[model samples]
Target: MSPHDQHETPGIDLARLRPWFAEAVPQARAEALSATLITGGKSNLTYRLSDGGSSWILRRPPLGHVLATAHDMGREYAVMAALADLHAVDPDAVGLGGFGRPQSFLTRQVARWRKQLAASYTRDLPDAVTLHAALEERATAADAASRPGIVHGDFRLDNVLVDGDDRLRAVIDWEMATVGDPVTDLALMLLYTRLARLVGPEIAPTPPTSSARRRSSPGTRPAAAATSATWASTWASRPSSSPRSSRASTSATWADRPSAPASTASVAERSTWTWATVSSPKGGGQWVGPGQDRVLALIEEVGLSTFKTYVDGKSIYLRGGKRQTFAGAVPPMKPSALADFQRLAVKLEEMASTVPLDAPWSAPRAVEWDSTTFGQWLDANAATDEAKWLFTLAFTVIQGEDPHLSSLLLILFHIAGCGGIEHMISTTGGSQESRVVGGTQRISQEPAKRLGKRVVLSSPVTEIRRQDRGVLVKSERVTVRCKRVIVAMSPADAGRIRFTPHLPVRRATLQRRWHNGTESKLFAVYDKPFWRDAGFSGSAMTDLPVARFVVDNSPPDGSVGILLTFMGTAGSGPGLTWSDAVLDDPRARRDALLADLTKLFGPKAAHPVRHLEQDWAREPWISGRVSTRPPGLMTQYTDAVSRPVGRIHWAGTETATVYDGYLEGAVRAGERVAKEVGAAL
Candidate 1:
């Protein structure tokens, strides 16, 4: 079938299967097979193979669409199926019981929490800095003083069951349990004080004299239960305290992959492109190093065809969802974009390999990848100026800056292996990293618990003055001495702080030059998501000046619906000029947003019960969603922005090397700066 063919049989090749099935599974050789087409579409096509008496399941690649390793039938059926069976077996059989490694486990848990929180810092959280600063003294102390042993991470009453005789039936779910501080498990049980709140069937109260509470399943259940109760017995009364990129740290390789040949099959991915191949005999160079092995494994895991995402013109087709045909100038732009994507893919792979991610200017091929502005990069490769505008404008919304060519490359390479451009373009519905539910406030909870009374919430530090061998942190009615100080706010807010001795010229100049990218979230509140009934997936993008992206942020419980439209910086979005009063007026902003929304989503959108706007330009502490450098500014100040000045250090998402403008970057930057300050102290 041609790549353009819409008709599909989804029928299994019964003749081709006769020998292959016999080879793979000898038991199936005796059956004379017949197949029926069950279903087929963009995903895997299925067929029911029968031999009159019994049937077998068959699955194969879709006729036109294939997602490389994403739809791996081999791993899906062979490797995972067997591994899942093994996992279902008894845990004690695999020596999971009494896997005691106390200090190591607690230490790793704390480190993991810090790392996860760091990734979640898409926005600024200054309290997180104050909390993290006190964490080492607080979060780690509980581990050292407690008795280390086996503990269930969540020892809930609902996780257990009792029979009619009031006998212990089974103890299940050991996922969170491990050998660590046993006291923590008791803490979770104590927190679940309300018996009515249990997720399992209500258990009859055990008589004070009953020994039946000790019975459980398997050979190890009796011992496990006794140990748990024994550990819990000493924990009735206790004290409490709390809480909380590689490259840019994904192992996915763009520069590296298994260079293997593709079959001359009719599948769209392998049909046209002649993939360059290399042979590594039976035993190639040991697949060496932690970094190297991980890179190759990531390449294989994501699949060889992942790099060919641009080979088909499906980028637009996929992102458009049901609205496959483009209207107006979009159709014209689509043609040039397809060819550009193909060229960009090849060029990106070269850049991914040659460019040094952390310091692009230091790359041996910096002249090609980094020594140019992003506009220059586009013009050099693009066949037309319109192509340049299309990409440059889109990138402006993504990166928030256009100073260095590497900024463009950073966003490009990050999404290169993400299957296709559709995902990168579909900016609605949020992302996996957006799970930080309570916004920046989520960043403060753990820190508040750990820091306790030490966390001064409302006090604003008025002056940071240097004293002999220490610094004076002065706020309302307070003056505190600290050996080291970390300014975790934006460079703009940090600039508001008066440095008594004054920062070095380079540091001061950096603070003045770093600019926050302008952005506004046009949030519309609705009674319910009306778009779903109209077959809309709640995601859309457009070239219109009013809103480039619109997202359906419906509450999970269907209580209300919210739509967020954007007015990105770089003079894009809602066609509003940067006049102070025009941008500041809430009513004007709301009406204009409703008018634009009515054009896109119809009259229902115009009648939103409430409209909320968060212009980053108007936020007290944050002036922009991300920080960006002007044309010539980075070369002068890149090195000095994050440099430790005397006892002061800088940290924020913009300072990150990976996911630079994202929340993940902020968390990473926080951790890095915290370490830098800790070392000096």
Candidate 2:
């Protein structure tokens, strides 16, 4: 065959391989070399090179398509070179300190498959999403419990070269080799044995038959038993094929395929409570959480209530220091003031709607939006001070910051395309509509109950030190070591903890600059929903300095009446401010709050059986309620806020992409970080 005219091996260049091989192996010389493609290997291509006198094997990535991290020729070569010293090899003794990042290697492997699966998604198949999710959930603990070693990513009969006597010869196909839990290699080997039963013995190798081989295999029964039903279903779900080529090929098998669903759907799709579609982020999916609200689905799977049932079309707002009862979110404004506010709201909404939730902070439109503050936008658009005050009252409570100091991009994120604040609250089912059945506290307590003794109480972590293999977390009562740590508090609170090696300058700056909004909640409990009896929804938005907004926190049965007050000090210029004297004294604060309630609800609001106040600023662990960003801060370090610094990951309401200052944002951030840490584990 002419080297130029006829090419048998698809990826191998005959003309180039001959001279290159001669140079690589200088002792071996040949005028012409013949190459033949080797079959059986699925991921990286293998070829047999013969110069008549000597033969050698050559491997390369498969032709047409390649999965990320699945094919690394250099990594394959490194593993082979490192294993050459196995007879007397000590990874540290050989100066291979940076050989591979062993920390969270198994978790990374699981996450790698998840991302690759999402990238190569075609159509949904049974057990694909479920199996992948289960693996991710368990990956962290699995990595923590295991020892790290060079993992042969794919360890099976086809990838190994054996002698005629069936004795070991050499292990090939090192493309997927990496520093990870060595048990993965054992698991995959055993899984292949299991696959033989599902795909038939012809396609997969049989289990060990010889006594020596059987004995060498580490207690086969328990390992196979531990593989679980998910592993079995993983093997039986779908055929291995390239979605891009749509060709039947075992290049990627059911045993090793990605399992994430292709579609970008959200929690609303699976929610039992009706979620308004307009309130959803741009892609109709949450900015965080598993692809289709799987994190939320897990909460439900654990038997926790996600949302509550509420009477439809019931809302109230306080305007001009008057109690105005409204069916929806239309806060009572003077006719001219309302008209002026609409014009400004429409202008800001138009600009904000252009920025999608998933758009990069550095995107052109995003950059433009961040270029100005909400105050700047209002200054240019609002015709009257009343219009500006209306904007302030609505957004300040939602965002937990003075609008002048907030990026226009931030304000737009909440109100974009949903009209302004009024439309977002009422038409979109609003943020304030639903309450968790028992209270939000149940969400945290339920998980702790399941964890039992593992969940340590009164152990507040004060320091996190990065060790060579993992992190050491020191708390008041206990110290723990982990491969990866997720800091779920606000950036401001995280600043209180000492980091041994210290954080990157950009990240440290973010923590230092992450200021909190001084916000507090006050709840008044009464015998009945008396405000409801007067044809009021028991919800009010007030311009009062002490009580900013009020909502009905009654049980579904309406057995007791509870009015929850959201109070905060806002504004840099002359706008609204919380009374410091009232906040300092409990009795004075209660008196002032009740007085405001009396003005809004009537004389019946004067007495309450119980009044509970939560001043977030006074909390030891939490210095403030929600995080607020200054005008230019987000533009400078938007990516750095959530980006992992080595083994540490950031999670909190502030780190979320959608609803960044709300409880929903906190849940989403937790979900996002859980997946992030799980992947690395």
Candidate 3:
């Protein structure tokens, strides 16, 4: 019977499947076919397809959203069903000699899973990174000790089919099947049995053990029990229901399965793609230790604060008015004026919504947004002074530039499209929710410690030149040659490097044009968190010239009080006039900050014990904190930002497609370049 004559299956396009199935298995020539949905895991949709005399299994990605890498039917097909009798067949003898690259298989597996995990990143998972690093470090040794063979990636009791006589019939669900260490297959099988016991029989039902000691299972195997235990704990917090690519939310209950335990569900809904069974090359061993390394694991490991952000303490100060609820200046101004401001804010956001966030850079809509400045848009749309001042303050505080200089598209992308005012202000679990116990200096310091002498401290690279099969990097004190180099710096810093061949005209021009925002950080320390007693969150926004943005920077214990102030050096922001003089003179800067703090949080703010200041613009090598694309720049040559140039690859926050100019973006960029370089090698 034709596919059109058959009842439609939710996932199967029967019309396409029938012909393809017929071609792949020509012996199954029965005219009629039927497919029944198989009850199973949420990762892939499986169906039992049948002709009158024969039945076959068909699997594909989940219905609504599919992560491309997670469900590869081609990968499963490559191993073939005939090889499922792993105990009886030899792969090389069966014309499967070129099935997979077995060299350094363990090392490659570590890198492959790390890259995959990066793809599905929702938030920070330090355990994932640490686990990856540990695995990678041991992979080389592990590979050398192991013998390569056709490995069944996920060998378990459930995955194997048995005849009525209780003899081995066939193994199934070979999506992760590949040529690698045979021990990995045996290990994963044992690990599953262990998981069944540890997580409880209800969630992970298992068959009776071969041993007479019923309590003893594969988990008790001494060979790698310690490693397996660690791996199990790592996975216990990970959601196994979803594929590597699927952005499975915690709220999404798995279909045809019991709900995951609260301990696992509460930790993270999304899987970190740590199957550790992928087949790919170990991303090359060229090491250039540039610096060091967030979310929950970071907070615990680094001893961070969990202070609740107080909305009452977060006040917005207006000229000649008392500080009030940060509700867009409602208390200080008339209701009608505040109402106009609120209306205009919503109107502007709605206008920005017209332009899609993911529109191509070359699209007319994107071009229009990129070309128009926030100031220009305000002049046309914003009706009242209240609207103009509030919008401008929010934009300048968040973006580190005045509305006149920043692109409307940049604002829309970072502000309206991103999350709106709440995100910018750092509400609970927002960007500014917590601070590392120590300064972020520890981020670079920890990695530098690991790298030891490999990290050439104070040695700045001045030039880079392409050589035979590699590139030459020259620093002030040392020079090195490597196969490829990831220049993990902002465009401005990258532009300072003298390339021997001179980068492409567009690339060079882009680097030169990519300027940094004049943002500076200031910290005022005191005896105790006095503002908390005063019903203040120690967070404030003002039109003050010295400090445009303020937040509580106290330690987790609250033993000492601190107020972090963000000031801009130039443009139409409030800090434009006072930033220069204050940044130059230490005393004047502290005095100015205290004056503003006092005005915002009362007299107690004036008597700080210590002051700390960091003007990013004045910092060496790192000219600024973040790269800011100006009007017309992002659209003009943004293509060259991430596009590789021969052996030279780029990995910076700016090159990231998501959360660009942030730490998260930087990590994502590093993972992307690692994969690119690995493939190239």
Candidate 4:
């Protein structure tokens, strides 16, 4: 019986099975048997043998000439027995025929085919010779002591059957199984997964290539020979056979099977590809380290390309590539206002550079200013100070006028004492508290509690939509449904969350127009608070540092504390020794920062206890500092910022037009959104 003969063989008739059933098992008389040819094997014939009441699988060697070492039915039976005893095989699934039981008709046919196939092909043929060589190599490797196992030569999806629920019902065709290196099984499984997409659920009858056949043919058994050599060497050092115990140990090989879920399978496949690529000598080894090499090897073996593709597609670099150029190209400067703003920007930069390196009033100070007094200070200093002037200019360019300095000042004067100036004076006059300006109490610390809880932090949310019963927050995690969500984030964060049932077009439009003030903040903790004693306040608006303004963080008790600094705009560039490249390097970042601090606060500020920096550009959750509108955003999006979208409402600093990027804006947005949600509920 050749391979073709096995396929063409007629199945046993159920009607004629009565006599066989009477002799074999009288209880099986009521059962009928139907044989269906199973596909997916190159070296074996497998069939689904269904009795009237139950189904069983039959497996045997392929039709035609077979190699001496190929299609070992005994080895297959041993592996199945081990797996079954371990309960690794699903109980609902059937197993191979028991030892001593009469073989099924299908099995007899398969044996006949194996005999025929063995004689059909000659060793002279190139394909046959290659196939034999491959098998020899595999057998030699399998025989190595360290690689001992009952190897499953082929374990592709097509060889396995699943029930309606997608549970593995049976694994068929074990003719190529052998007691040898277990890694052979792993290699076969990996190969199967790679070819699965193209080959479908069934295993293909042909080898991947002639070379593969030579490497994998059973008679050659090169892997087995290698395994045997290793085993012999080990035994030479400490002699022991212990065949039974060694066979029992093979059960541990299947331990990994149950955990091999579909997702894991996909990841495994991708890892295999990545490993192959990286391990290839053509790819430079410069980037390969010990850990990375191991990872690449595993990835190659497992074929992890799919997972890698998914991750790369969602990275910040790809997502922000196009948007990063927006600020440079657009400049956010209107055509009519471009010249004036450009001139003001230059003047402000020059004035900032000319400011004294040391100043008494420049240090960080506590201020308790009413809105009116703050407004008065702004009015008095707006024109003289370059920083304030540039701010006002930018505001005027974006907004038609500065309402805070104009209309809001009058309101503040009526309600409190004087306008912005008086308010600033009052706040500055307040007694200095502990050095740290914004303590833990002032900042939300909820994140601290969620640590180590599988939190998905830092990933930017692309969109949010409302579901039937709850809201869906979509991040890298699949859509998460939440009944109540705290949008206690930035306005930019709020704007990005897409709502379902459509947020009113007005609200969506408002969100796009609102801007989170893009500013950079830096904090440097020095060895001691030395600047205060030198009559130099910690705060200064200077061109020496990247930040336009710095705050003195010296404690009243004289302990070393943090000095906070802020860049008024995103385009400050680098200050002193701080180049763009240095700022990006973690170690250089701190050094560059300290270099600037020393310039402003004198030599004593050269070394800091710690350095902390924040770049709003790369921060996903809070893309920018707070909301700073272009001149007209307030009139446009102010009313709609906190408006409700069906049951969902918006909240964040950007949503608050009154104090857009300030802490006050956050509070305002929160209060307003809470009320809106309350009303909806």
Which candidate tops TM-score?
Answer: 2
Residue 530 shift from truth in candidate 4, angstroms: 2.0
**Candidate 1 minimal-lDDT segment of 10 residues:** 245-254
> What C-alpha lDDT values do all the predictions have?
0.46, 0.59, 0.58, 0.38
**Which candidate do you rate higher for lDDT, 1 or 4?**
1
Count of backbone collisions within predicted model 2: 2
Q: Give the TM-scores of the predictions, in the order they appear.
A: 0.47, 0.54, 0.53, 0.37
Candidate 2 lDDT over 74-176, as tens digits, reads 6666656556422234455545546777888867878888887887779875446766765664566455556666666776666654334544445566666
Candidate that beats the other on lDDT, 1 or 2, i.e. the better one? 2
All candidates: CA RMSD in angstroms? Answer: 28.6, 24.9, 26.3, 24.2
Per-residue CA lDDT of candidate 1, range 1-681, in tens?
Answer: 332123333444455556666665455532466555442122444444545554444555457654443344442232212121222333344454444467655556667667768877899887566545444323343454455555545454443433345444333234344557765665665555422222111111221221112222122121111211111111112223322100000000000122211211211123121111000001000111111222234334333211110111111212322334232213245676657755765675656565444654454544344335556666667775545555655555554444232344444434432223343333222222122222333343444344333333333456667656766555432244556666666666567667878989988887786676666667888888776665554444555435555656654554676777666434332222233323444445566777756666768888876666555554444455566555444544546767777766677655666555554455567668766766765
lDDT, candidate 1, equals 0.46
Q: Of 2 and 4, which scores higher on TM-score?
A: 2
lDDT value, candidate 3, whole model: 0.58
Distance from true location, Cα of 213 in model 4, Å: 36
Lowest lDDT block of 10, candidate 3: 275-284
lDDT of 4 by residue, 169-203 (tens): 44544455443334444555565444433322112
TM-score of 4: 0.37
